[model samples]
Target: MVLEQLEQAVCPQLDYDYDLAIVGGGIVGLTLACALQDPGLRVAVIEAKQHSVAASKGQAYAVHQLAARIFQGIGVWAKMLPNIAQYRRVRLSDADYPGIVEFQTADLGTDVIGYVAEHHALLAPLQEFMQGCSNISYLCPVEVVKTQYQPDCMEISVSMNGELQTIRTKLLVAADGARSRIRNAAGIKTRGWQYWQSCIVAFVKPEKSHNDTAYERFWSSGPFAILPLPGNRCRIVWTAPHEEAKALLALDDVQFLQELQHRYGDQMGKLELEGDRFMFPVQLMQSDRYVLPRLALIGDAAHCCHPVGGQGLNLGVRDAAALAQVLQNAHKNNQDIGSIQILQQYEHWRKRENLAILGFTDLLDRVFSNDWLPLVVVRRLGLWMLRRIPVFRVYALQLMIGLRGRIPQLAQK
Candidate 1:
């Protein structure tokens, strides 16, 4: 059903009670709502924009193997199969370092390193899936004006037509983007800062085939990644100083493409800009907490990390899965899913895991993006040793594929 029809179908009833209410229609929010919905429980999702508002452009993402498994568990993968493109390998290179370091799926005994897909194409099917399920109610294009936590339940005030309406739910989740209003109202604290670098993201049509592989190249400025999609199209994420980014983005399409070619080398052959380029300031954000009294945060709302290793969405997906499993287990055990005890467990499970990933990505961003001779020598030798040792290479590949650690319940076969 169209988003408009979906919104109109909802009954105008106040004092609606839900098992869970998620504030944010982004991927993580919607996924969490869908995951928590079942025959036994009712879930609702509230987003600031109407469903008719399409997902943003110039924001494509790569999903790790664990994320692929989570999608399968939620039953969205089958619907999204047509738009998905698997990348069997990835090539990481440094201009000053000798030789290239490659991570192949075969080396890890997997079929693909990961999958690359456009944000809209992936999210539309998820929304459609949520609509068909009877347990989910989607509230879009409505601003969350107030959020109040009481001893019994969490109360939310939403504005639709300059009139305020209240929603009460057993549990409240905040999946809104970076600046989460729900999180702010809950009085949760977050710690992060903006990076000196900015990222330029754009879709380009290349003259040569990408061969279903992604490339990450490090330069003095920052890391540039070219992720291959299904067609001759590629998504480019070029990181550099904010001033340099502004200068590059101001050039005409021809001049911009030329600069891209020079920095990107001949790997993808000639490139023609297919769409407008977008620039986003980079930051490393980690929340002080992910859960509070009957409240929780997910996705960029909870933590934002550097995109050096492309783990942002993957971490969010895992958060959704972890919360879902915890709730399911609580229900099975006749426990209160929204109880502080249950919420704290969820926080404990995800906080440590999220911090580990944040630290690893931060280290990579600092070590690889630097021009320091000592750090460069150490990293080059580290890469060389991994390549030379077959066992170490396979293990590294497995880690990159998100297969090295304990598999989450939803991700388990």
Candidate 2:
């Protein structure tokens, strides 16, 4: 009855400048806008930074199969495919452990397990695609000043190219990031903690071919990952204690490569630093709520998890696809898109799913990133089970590549 009253209270006579307005034009935000390319619904994306700035971050992500399908649905996968490196196999091992659990495409019955693409490879295509989208108004270098929630629409005050303007939309989506200003302004609390670890990431050129294989080797300190990229190059994510990570970053390129080689193993042969190294503290964060009246949160704004399995961006991609489905359905039914009743559909669909990944990553980090004798034994045994049992291996692979959740229609192959 309250929902009915709220819907009725919204005057049909009032006009909104856009049906949906998204803040933060990063990968997640752009994915959402691309997914909602409907002629009937006008969408606006307000970003504080330029695309060039974001693309220059020198970071890369493991793009799961579901996320690839979402991009395919949005018609950007082809553009991204050439620039990405597809890894058909993944090797999971522990510090100096002879028993390495290897996963192949056959394990998941897929052509490729996942793809790795640099920040520019993904962001440039999405930005170029947005240029041709008529329904989307891309406003970059625009700062969001404030947001006012009205009974019928969301009033967003933004400073665009030095001019201040208020844009009205039926729904406001925040994909800004983990430190989202929009989310904080809405007073939405998050539940998680700053991990004791930080991750140092850099690109390296391997003397030999990577053979399209990704590696995750765990140590007492934290997890280290080698993600294959095109041109026989690889992106490495090295996690360690905060101060230790800082100290490692202080080393010269040759010294840094020496330290990296110790953990990276001899599988890829000699390695040379390809670019600047970057580091950031790791954390686990989940919003207490994902929606409020006319507002919604997706991507890093909604949750963050450890990079143990490279699940961060994939989660955000799935969030964009799922929320897109919900909003598209509401629009089709001619319902109030920003109604709490409608927005809750998105919250319910993603919150538990995201929580599951968060728990899985936290458990993996805790179990493997310590030398506790009991945990060490348990993890070794667990890894043995994963290696010996076909069912266990398949289930684990599915989860890693995002096949275990309630997949959205947009991501459906």
Candidate 3:
């Protein structure tokens, strides 16, 4: 049975409490729940924190074109649009370098290059959308104590309101984040290392209008990004050596703003701090496998990469959509959604694509985050080529905005 037939067919009764249970109610897990919101499959989302707490986070993300389309398909884009900031151009420059590369919307023949959305802006809408999805049971402020896998179903023990309860599901998904307890409990190994560098993120109010342009300025120390936000504010993702980043974060607001202005240049005029600064060590990680038996991993549980291009969450968004597509297809065909055979289809489809992005981000950070003469010369020449060649610009933009992969059906419309 295909999708049409499955929709027309009566909802089949199942022995398990739910068809799927997702651990981690972050953006990715919630996205998966929203995508799998059909009556045929009862779903559950297990979260350790309340929705209000997650929605109050200060982080923001660069929502690529493909991710925006995925949100549109999920029916939350209209609600998210009011809070999203669209950028028409992206400026890539090396520190004080004469050669620079700029990407315009015309390069891709799209309305805009991409969008910037705050954590609250995204999570609030997603949570609101899920409230209307009757098939999705959101169990928040609950802790997962243990998980036991059986031949036919997985049993999960949880602590909710100080009481232990068990829930059974046909499939289990781990979206718990990089230090995912579910993935660790299952003994899934990962490969990657912590970088000597760290990233400092903060919001700033620019004196001049950003003109809907995003800036990526690379220095020998690290890459500094200025992402335009709603209300003429800009998000700063400043990368630097670990010690240096810590010192910067410790400085008073006045001192920090002084340093910020030096790196930010005068294009945006004076920049005022909008909120507290945050720092986190950077790393690259990929699971040995995306799935096993009745267990599967998505988002940070599956992989993590450098945040240079703002690709982290977008990767997870795509993972959610792809997994949703694969699982729906399996359900329609009357196959076990958690069977390794069916799960591997999603793994095969996304793992390589994700690896490509991981490698690309690593290469970018390594190549640009230094003043090595040979590499500097090479990178400068690359920028020159990117500026002179429309095809190069288009290809690079496509990759950054997630237009270079096997798009899931949910994002197609």
Candidate 4:
């Protein structure tokens, strides 16, 4: 039953083949299918693994309001909502600086600020929805070995269930990820750099209850975020420079806890580890072009930003919605779905917001991860003054809620 759960996140009619062929059936790919499903367009998702294997790579993600609405539009939110933890309050603080700012869900007049849920929790339901969609076909346990971009159609060659097969479509959407095969074969160039820092993550139980509060503490080392989870447990994402991250990874549970306390203080009280710890390098990546010929890139394939705001996945989901909107509109007008003209519209609409977010997150990491006196003073003053300025405070609150410029129609509830 659990294995079959991801089958119907989208709905459509009977079709063996597709008009749009999606590579990499990760979150963005599945979400794109769901977003495009309501229109009864034929779609096929080619993935590297079958349902069971791809369904449960247990990980966690914090979903912003914009993305949550996209999931609701695709018809899986109602099922996934029960397993999510809502953040009632969000606190931003610094280790060596006196700057502190707190944002409340009450201030925004919303039932929830945002959600923290396991990656599999979100993936399973979307996968289930996909299975039930008649017009959307799934090609699982396959690897994309060759991709050909033609003037009229795109061809993706894969080894499916131990046999070689090629799928032809009007458009090819890449949702693979940072190291995207679809992107590379399409000759799309990317520009980004490794942050020289790594993220150390783990789940832990704290002496004091998190009380549905999310805390992000900035230190010269990097930003450390402790997001609340059910049962008084917390998900910790600690961004530290390379050496520090390696040291943290090498420590015994007690030693690592001690170091965490030294940097994070006792805000959540004594902490105890729950699961395995992990260290991963963080980087910024952006494709030179999101569309070329009949091919398009979405999600991590198009862009990636710092995880400071937890906006990477949300940004990717927005791409899926925008692309689906353009394709849906083009279909209504009886235009070529993969035409250069139609794909350009999707590129233009998404690029504006994507660039702004990349810059904002980069600035957050650079500014907060420093001890430069003058800049530190200015940042601290800004945070302290924000509390007294009602209008400005509201403006900042809205940005955190993913309510700023140019939201996709599907993202609107």
| Candidate with the greatest TM-score versus the true structure | 2
Which portions of model 4 miss their true places by more than 4 Å? 1-16, 96-98
lDDT (tens digit, per residue) of candidate 2 on 193-259: 9999999999899988899999999999999999999999999999999999999999998888889
RMSD of 2: 1.4
TM for every model, in the order presented, reads 0.93, 0.97, 0.96, 0.93
Decide which is better by TM-score, 2 or 3: 2
Query: How accurate locally is residue 378 in candidate 4, as Cα lDDT from 0 to 100?
Result: 77
Q: List, residue by residue over 1-413, the lDDT tens digit for candidate 3.
A: 46653343323345899889999989999999999877378899999998799788889999999999999998989999999899999999999997879999899888899999999899899899898999999999898999999867889999999999999898899999999999999999999999889999999998999999999999988889999999999999999999999999999999999999999999989889987999988999999999987899999999999989999999999999999999998889777787777788899999999999999999998999887899989999899989999998899989988999999999988
> Which runs in model 3 stand beyond 4 Å of their true positions?
1-14
Return the candidate ranking by lDDT, descending: 3, 2, 4, 1
State the displacement of the C-alpha of residue 107, model 1, in Å, after optimal TM-score superposition: 1.6
Q: Model 1: which residue pairs collide? A: 49-141, 50-141
| Candidate 3 residue-wise lDDT at 291 | 94
lDDT of 4 by residue, 309-383 (tens): 788888888899999999998778666777766788899988878888888888889988888998788778777
Candidate 1, residues 368-388, lDDT tens digits: the string is 878899998888887887778
Best by lDDT: 3
Q: How many collisions between residues are there in candidate 3?
A: 0
